[model samples]
Target: MKKIYYSLLLTLCVGVSGFSYALQDAKNIMESVKYRDQGVDRYSDVDLIQTMSDGFVRSRSLKMYEKEFGEERKGLLYFTEPSNTAGTGLLMYSYAEVDNKEDDQWLYLPALRKVKRIATNSKEGPFLGTDFSFADIERMRIADYVYTLKEEKENISIIEAKTENGLENPRTGYSQRIVHVDTDKNIIIKDEIFRQGRLIKVFEVVQLEKVNGFWTVVEAKMDNLVEGGSTRLIRKNTQYNQKLKDGLFNQRTLRKGLD
Candidate 1:
């Protein structure tokens, strides 16, 4: 009996140690992805296509600008196509200081001719009638989640993440996310979003290439499982580390449209 008891205890110890190491490895991988240096500024023209359940498709075009300021990142997006959405714009500022402060977001509606601040409670709403939420477009902070390695394949590592450190918004759409990371490149290739323990959406990186020494996703798709629809975002004419004006990301620029 003594010999059998010792063997079981030894096995349990090894299992626990392996689990701890896996968790640490998953966190390290996520940190690499979150902190990867893209560039100081980036500009891109994007095509947004939304496919409906009844086989209808709508398309729009957007001009996007991004810049890094200290630890904060600013983004501006302006619609350029579909006449009706031509002047619609969104401005966002993501802060590195995580002290219970939410990110800043603003929307400019051409019909209203005004800029409206997006409240934290409404960040979970679909972005411009697309499959992506406002929160999805913002930068993700590493400290906001606890990650564990679920599985590791030869080319990919699957990590399950749960919100921590008061990072989850009460009104957010997703409760947890399962991410498939490219082990070699340390980039997120796919994500499964769960809402109340039910899988609601799947996001996939369909194409990726290195742009100015940074890995960039050129084509991506988001499928809404419950809604029976999908949205595809394709990037073209991408330029990185450009000299974008600081004033372009402000609300004034959003309302006026990029000069």
Candidate 2:
């Protein structure tokens, strides 16, 4: 069996991205965020710092790479720091909203010596004992939720969306997400996730940069409201269009890791 004790040390999320457009309805704004141009290929060194409710802290390092194939986006990550967590990797493939396709994900746990596919129905679980869930890491489906333009506050557009089937949907446990989008850049700068009318998680961008003409998230934080802890994802040496090889995104890479 896989190492249950180390499962929390074996995973991570990719970039949360978006683009620019004229102000319109909620769907239009979200569409812009979902379809933003990231880049042809990219790479970065990432740090995941977690602060527990009891005041303990843990930090992990990762090598992250992303690339675009037509309209689909693929990303790969390899954990490289903290001896016990090294060699852990995650691979993801996200598609356009128009295709109505489900994004795919796989996690390689070094202890298990196997790459496990993340099922669509199990995306709600937390990542690396952090506040961010697998669903938060995956590409957001425009069809899965119905959005409404709640209000406009200065440069931020406050919008809310509810899962189509609500509580009955096994695909995601969170029934609602209230997103704060940058009105000018058309990107999600913050998000508050809710379950059964209770606020449980909050994600906010700590820093951003225009790298190689592409908007990139330099740092972000996910706070677990219910759990009283937080995770800060800090990106360093972020670069766009590295012409990353196709070999980096497959399951084989997950097992071998990014060298």
TM-score of each: 0.91, 0.87
- Taking the tens digit of each residue's C-alpha lDDT, what string does model 1 give over 1-259? 9999999999999999999999899999998887678789999999999999888999999999999988788999999999999999999988875565678899999999989998878988999898888878877766657889999889899999877642454546566889999978878999998877789899999999988888899999999898889999999989998999898888888767776
- lDDT to native, each model: 0.87, 0.83
What candidate 2 gets wrong by more than 4 Å, as runs, is 1-24
Which candidate achieves the best TM-score against the true structure?
1
Clashing pairs in 1: none
Error of 1 at 138 (Å): 1.4
